[model samples]
Every structure is written in structure tokens, then in C-alpha cells.
Target: KKKKKKPRGSGGGDPGCPRVSKPSDDLQTSRKSGFFSALPLRASLRGYGFCMAALFLFCFGSLFYQLNGGAPQILQDIRHYLGKKFSLPRALPFPSQVVYNRVGKCGSRTVVILLRLLAEKHQFNLVSSDIHNKTRLTKHEQVDLMKNISKIPQPFLYTRHVHFLNFTRFRINQPVYINIIRDPINRFLSNYFFRRFGDWRGEQNHLIRTPGMKDDERYLDINVCILENYPECSNPRVFYIIPYFCGQHPQCREPGVWALERAKQNVLENYLLVGILEELEDVLLMLERLLPHYFSGVLDIYKSPEYKKVGNLTGTVRKHTPTLEALQVLYHRMRYEYDFYNFIRDQFHLTKKKIGLKSASQPPAYSSAFLRELTLRTPKPLDEDEELESDLEDKWLLWCPS
Candidate 1:
């Protein structure tokens, strides 16, 4: 028999996974607080066998990435280079340092809620800053925050609306990244006219208190604003997907050829999962599979009552005021975003197929029963990490020497 490996930090699992204690299913109390506190002595023959298996799977993810091709230009569209990119066949996890760089108006709140639920359910620490309505965290503040997390006893999930940037500068364990993007057109519309409009609308807000509101007209004022100064409007406010994904830099917002390419490449390298807002169900299912260790029981929570109540408020359109014509005209002014949207849509479909899921672009019809199953609520505060004990055993056994 082989031996076992020690976790680099406390509460760690497997060999190179997160160092925090495995999150118990219920956050109210730890189911196995001392489960991995004692490091198994690997000097024995049996311990060595266990160590080899654990280490192989731990590094298998990197090998898979190298074999699966890389970010390259194709047909002048870099999106094709991201072939089967978002889906991970083998990957490692370091949960405490995981960061969800939430982009604004990208249905990011739903992702945050899901992360919060996972943190609470697993009993992992969640270092969510109460900071709200901001685009980026100050570099010094980010550095200090990461430093503080190292002193804490549990793993953490940092979820907030922040643009992507090099976190290594903060001198921390490089965080595993995950985020979702939206059809730029829809995201633009959502940001353009949702919430705080004519007091929940059938009417319009006369003041147009929105920042960067150049002209406070009664109608689609941004339309006119674009015609007068296209670059100023499109570059700053409307064309945001590239800037958000590309990380914080002046060149990122250049609205040039290199800018788009850099954003695509950054996504390919940094983010483990880059899901689309349109194929949300597939994304959630994908999360459970890819990070099964961390998101084990998350799949069942979708149908629970507390999950639904939390989900519905953010899932559906809270209100709407834009017309089809408004979107059509807006599209004309935002051709770059249109290109970005189409590329990501194709990427999502291709990724689903590579991972053995039905093509998201052409999903089959769901029965009424299945449709209702999606909304039937279950009690809140999700269950324990039942998969941990079994998963640990099953994974090692697969590689045990015969």
C-alpha cells in the first residue's frame, strides 16, 4: 500500500486541494472538525501508494490543459482559439483563495448567492467584503485583505463586483478564478434601463440621474449621445465586456484590435470556468462536475425553497422598459460588442459538447414536470458534504496499486 500526503495548509483535502478543513454540509456545525487534523505518516509502504495516486490526479489537470490546445488566433476571431477552453476535464482546487471577479449587470449576483450558499453549507470562511456598487478594489486594500485571510482558520470565497487584475501583486496564493459573461447587447440593455426607473415603470424617470448621462432627454438619450460622440459613449459605458474581462489596464479599454485579443487570451489563461449568462442551467451543472469537491451538493439546492426564493429575486427581470427598436438601434452603435457576444455564444455551445452535455445552443424541450421541478422549493441552509468521505475513498482506490 502507498502513503498519504500532507495538506499545505489547514483544512486541506487531497494533496494540492484547498488547505481549509472540508466544509461540513451544514454551516451550523462541523461534521468532522478533526477529520484531517492528523497528518498520516507517509514513511510506510501503504502510505506511499496513497500519496502517488493523490499526487497524480492533483497534477493531472495541468497535463490535460497542455494537451487540449491553447489560446490561438483563428479566422481573425480569437474565440475559436478557446476550443473546449472553459470546460476542465481535470483540475485542482484551492478554495480559500478562490475569487469570483463579478462583472456588473452580468447576472453576477446569482453567482454570488450560489457562492455564499456553498461557503455557508461547507462551513468554509467567506471573506466577502461589504463593499458594494464599485468597479474595482484599490490595490492596497486588496493586498491587505488577502493578507488578513491567511491568518483566518477557514477557506474563503471572495465574491464582489470587481474587474480582473493581477492578484499576485498582493503576495498571496494565486486564486482559482470563475466568472460568467452575458450577451453584451443584453447586458448593455440591462444596465441601461433596469432598477430605479419611473418608480418601477410604465413611466420613465425624468431626471435621468445616471452617471455619464450627457443629455437628459425624455427618450433613449444614450442613442443621441452615441451619434454625437461614438467612441466616448461606446468605449466607456457600453463596450464593457472586454474591459471587465481583460483586467485593469489603460490598454484594456483601447477599443482596438489588440484589446479584444488580449481580453480573450486573459480569459483563456486566468479563468477556470467562463460561463455564459444564457446557458445558466448548464453552467450550474458544469460547476458541480468541475469542482465536485467544493460544490458537491449544490446541484440539489437549485430546487430548494430557500434557493428558489433567493434565486427568483435575482433570476428574473425585476422590471423592463426597453423596446426591441431600442435594442436594434443600440446594436448599430455597438458592433464590437455584437462580435464579442456571438463569439462567446459559439464558445459556450462548443464547450458543452466537449464536456458531453447536449449542445446548449440546441437544447431539447423540457417536460412540464421537469420545468416545474426546477422551481419547487426545498428548505434553506443546504445539506452536509456527504460526498467527501466517499469521494476521498473512491478517488484513491482508482489509482491504488493492484
Candidate 2:
């Protein structure tokens, strides 16, 4: 046989391809040279087993991420590098508990009727309180009412003609709040007439509703009440809409910036969707979008002929528009109410836009003078140095980098 060139270096079998080392060969080399070399092959294999287990865990961990609706790490890394925020996709849970602390004469009766149908069809507990007259509860009453509401079964929607109750203040689990509001002047006019001559039902309904009212009180003229500044038509009473949102605080009843700001803040923090009565259809649409479980088929039910016939019965009879002069006085009285209503309306429109819904009525654009006046009314912040010094306990810095 031709003298076989002694297989090159330590490969010992072939010179043709220059021995291609396998991962097994590398492992063998590592095991033989390192601290492991002194141990048995079985001991070296134990380390190999640990490495294999780690790789297995890493693969399953990636699979687990994908199962819970997360993107792969490589794609997330690419998004990060591209300066895009990566949001992990997750299923949105339906809000089971909801509270519609209905404002008086804001078309809440119409909504409640629709809700009755919804509750039946959708099979959710609809605990609508029968107590319509009592809104502002005493401290003991608030605690009692909240306790009763808490005891109701889960996946329920509770509605009532009550002012906002701060569940958090009482340490109860706060429910998701939803409400409908109307133009301040329009709401006032509706209530003004409704108290005197009920709806399509009859005057008897008004009599039953306000049993203690005097005949003089029942037939009070809208123009006279507004122009003459009657208690029912003046400051605190005309300041109706704010307290419904601003909670049961005594200050909420007083017409001021504090109540207005507090109501606006509560709308942002507590209330889910505050719909306007003029845009009731859009309100239902938003409710369906926001709380699909409770309000899924609400819009369809509202549009039905059967529902329309029932809704017609609730319309305020002898509803008359106030004269321009009387309306001007009423508007001035409800300036703060108008401010809150405008804020809620704008927020509703913005949400509608976000969900690809078009509004038939757009909010009016303000003039430069009006905007300047609003800017002047806004609270001004102190300068940075002044703000820093005002709250600081120490005048001197503890440490500086440079």
C-alpha cells in the first residue's frame, strides 16, 4: 500500500478534507483541558445535560410569551431600535359594575327605559333605585346606601337620581360611573315646565311627583322666575349640573371656581363617559364602545319603534323656549354650569373622533377675546426658583455632581 501520510496533526484518520471538528469534538476538548478533565466522562456529561436544559427552558419561555399575545423578542427589539414604543397586546376585560347617577331631567328616564330592555336581554342585574326625590344623602345615609349597593350581585349596573358618592372616601370598591348631561339652560327649562305640567301621561303625574308643591309654585312663570331671581331660578339652584358631578360636598352646591374645577376633575377621574342629551345617539354609541357588555344592543333598542312609542310618553308637555332677555339672565346665572358642560362636550367629541365616529354638531370655536379671558382666569404657577424654595425644608443642597 502507498505509504499513507500519517493523518495530519491529531485527527489520525484523514488528510483529504482536513478533519472538520464537530461540536462533540469541541465539548470533548473543553472537558479534557479545563477543571473537568480530572473528572469522569459521566461528570462532563452532567454539565452538558445542564446546558441542554437551559436551552429547552429558553425556547418554552418564548412560546409562553407568544401564547399570552406578546410579540417575539426579535421583533420587539427591532421596534425598540426604531424608536417605537412596544405595547404588549392583552385582552380588555369588560367592566362589570357601572353606576349611572342620573341627573334630574337630563333625559335619564329615556335611558333607564332602554336599560330595562338591555338588562332583560343581556341578563345583568339592573338595580334602579325607586327613590327619586332624595339625592344629597346625609353621612349615615351615604354609608348605608353604599353598603346596600355593595351587597348587590356582581356584573350589575346600578342607576339612580343621586349626586356622585365618593366610594373611595368610604373605602368601598368604586364602580365605573357613566352619566348623561344636557345644555344647562335647556335642562333648567325642561325641569321648569315638567314640574308644572308633567309629560304626555298627564298633570296627575306631576301632582304625584311633587305632592307638597303649592299651586303658586306649580304654575310659576319661567320668565318671572328667571328675571326676578327667585331662589329656584337663582345662584345655587341654577348651579344644578355641577353638584351632580362634584360629589356631596357642601361647597359643591355653592356657585364658584372650586366646584367647577372639582366637577371637571371628577369627570376626568371617575366618570367613564358623560354624554350630552342633545347627542343622545352618540352617547349610546360611546357607551357601547366603552362598556360593550351592558350597552351592546342599547342603540338598536333605542331606535326600535316600540321603544320610540314609550319614549314619546316621557316628553315634557307645554315646553316653551324662554325669551332672549330671560335666557340671557339665565345664561349669566349658569356661567359655571356652561363651562363644565362645554368641557364634557369637548371630551365626548374627542372620544368620538378617536373611535372613528363623526359628530353632526361640532363644538363652537371661541373668539380670541373669550380665550384670552379664560387664560386670565387660569391659575398661574410660581417661578421655578420660587416654587422650589417655597416647599423646601433645607435651603442648602446636600450634594452636587460638579
Candidate 3:
């Protein structure tokens, strides 16, 4: 006003006068500045709130589900939480191989250990069920998931407790298929006693019914519950043995019908390399032939401890003879498949004389420690050499049981 103040809303204004503008421009500028100034802070707070809400929901949901006695669901939720925290690569970097292990208390763990060690040494990928696989998924669900996930066509090694039907679909050109079969009588006895009192939890008495149960129920009872409920049995028998050697139990056994048909089909279709756990030295030799680069003498494989362990045998309630007779009866009922296993053994040129193999025909070694170091955790690399020495001592005792 003193020196021609001009219009206050104009671009140029007096120094002491407050600036005024057209209502439209003022509104537009105010809106823009306001938004820009508050945008980052608002976004950050929103993100934090979202995470907190998710965490709260998950914890509340888990507790609610557990309280409802939905054990499977609770287990699944826990797995999901752990999985998200420890996600592995979708595919391993190097080409991986598959191994199908059959049942027996027959050193299957040692084989798994060897394969894991080899995979690590060669920088090849080892696909394990626990790390990341749909093994825990139901059969139908797992098959569908594998089909979709397999389309990526990356070279990765995967191993799991899979059935023959599921395993045969993979186009493994020269994959190694391995299985170890023990004497049917011994195996049956092992199965029977292990189910009775081993650390295995779940329906135990359902193993051998007290008569009047339907035959199919009997089969389901024996085949399904016994194998599924026990961890040791579940791992070797259900996962590897039944699938790789004996196929799923048939609805009816017509003549020429057998338990291992599907496994036979898979073997014919794929380059399967079967290994007898009893003849481990021969198995190692076959591995040398199959995978020369990795198995070559660069590493002394023989230094690997003997599979047998000397330990106390539990569940010896009555005289061994009666138990042996009962096992013998069961063995004969399943002898057809046992004969097939023997044929495979013969084809491999594995001989009992080559390795001091044990059989049902051989008398039981009562003093032998059959349960040696069963609870020992897998030794770390730094402790392996020492563990090996201890195992060697244990093996000496096992060999000279009496």
C-alpha cells in the first residue's frame, strides 16, 4: 500500500505483505505439497502395521487350531512357518541323481549318508524330502504339484519316499535304482518286534490282529498302519522298499500277479542299478562302474564303517524258537516276492561268501549288539573321523558277537 503494493495474489508482491493467490491454484498446490510431504511416512507405517497384523493372526490361528485337536493341521501350520523362514532354492544348481532304497534294518541310513556326502563333495544337488519337496503332500496332491513344478526342466537331484507309480513318471535316462533286501523271515521278525515296543508311537496292537478282522482290513492293518506309524519302518519300507521293490498291495492276487509289478515296470523303463545291502562291497563296486568320476579311488570308500552294529536286542519275552517259527510262517506267505528279491540278488552276481552276510537260516547271535548307536546323531565333518573309529570298534564286536 505504501509503495504500490500491486495485487497480493499476483506473482510479484510487497516484501511485508502476505501472499494471496487464486483459489484454484492455491488449492492445487496445497493438495500436492500435503500429499508429497506425508507419503513416505504413511507408507512406512502402513507396512509395519500389515506385518504386525499378519504375525498376530498366524499365532492366534495356530493356537486355536491346536486347541481343537486338529493335530495334522497344527503340524502342517508349524511346518509352513518353519518353511517360510528357511526356504531353500527351488532347484539345485547341479544335475542330481535319484536313489530308491528298500527296507531292512539293513544299513539304509549309511547309504543315505554316503549319497549325501557324495552330493556335497561333487557340488551336485541332493533333493531331500525334509529340505523342500512335496513328499508330505498327499499322493494325488504331490503328483499334481510335481508335474507343474517339473516343467521348469532344471537339472536337480531329488530323493524322497515316493511310490513306484509316482517315481516312474520322471524321465531319468540313466538313473541309479538301488534297494537292499533282507531275509523275509528276519525282516518279518524285525517288523513284528519293532512295532511292538520300539520308540514307535501310534496304534501298535493293530499289527497282528486277534482274528475276525476282515482280510482286507488285515492287509490294511498290517501294511498300512504298521509301516506308516513307525518312523524307522515308515522311512525305509513305505518310502523306498514297498515302492521300489514291492508295488502297492493289489485288490486281489490273480495267478502271475505279484507285489513288485510296478517296480519291475519302472526298472524296465529306467536304467535301474540295484544294490544289495548285504553285499555292500559289491554295491560299492557297482557304484564305481556307474559313477566313475565321483566314486573313483580318490576317496577311500572302504574306510566307511561296516553297516552292522553290536547292541542289545529288545523284546525277547519268550524263547527265540517260537518267535522264529511265527516269523517263518509270515515269511512263507510273502515268499513269492522274497524269491523275486533273490533273483535280483543272483543277477547282480552278489554272493553270500563275498561278504559275511546273515540270513534267517543262520542262527541268531544272542549276544550281538543289534541296536548299537541307533540313537547317535549324524556326526559333523569335524567329528566324522573320530566317529568312524568308534564305529569300527563297534563293528568288530558285532562280527564276533559271542
TM-scores for candidates 1 onward, in order: 0.56, 0.69, 0.43
Per-candidate Cα lDDT values, in order, are: 0.56, 0.76, 0.43
- What is the TM-score (0 to 1) of candidate 3? 0.43
Can you write out model 1's per-residue Cα lDDT over 1-402, one digit (the tens) per residue? 787756565545456565554455455344344443333443456788889989998688665543332212242144323434764332224554566777767777666677666765444555554443454445664565557545544355566555676767665666778888876666765665553342332333424434334344324455453444433244345657776677667666555567677777777777777788777777877776566544556667766888887676543233343343444444544455555655666666767777777743633222335323433431121112211111111010011111
Q: In terms of TM-score, which candidate is stronger, 1 or 2? A: 2
- Model 3, residue 191: distance off in Å is 3.5
Top model number, lDDT: 2
How would the candidate models be sorted by lDDT, starting from the highest? 2, 1, 3
Given candidate 3, what's the lDDT at residue 3? Answer: 86
Tell me the lDDT of model 2 at 355: 72
Ranking by TM-score: 2, 1, 3
**Every candidate's CA RMSD:** 26.7, 17.1, 23.3
lDDT of 2: 0.76
Two-way TM-score contest, 1 vs 3, winner: 1
Preferred candidate (lDDT higher): 1 or 2:
2
How would you encode candidate 2's per-residue C-alpha lDDT over 43-81 as one tens digit per residue? 779999999999999999876653333445476457545
* Clashing residue pairs for model 3: 96-157, 310-369, 311-369, 311-370
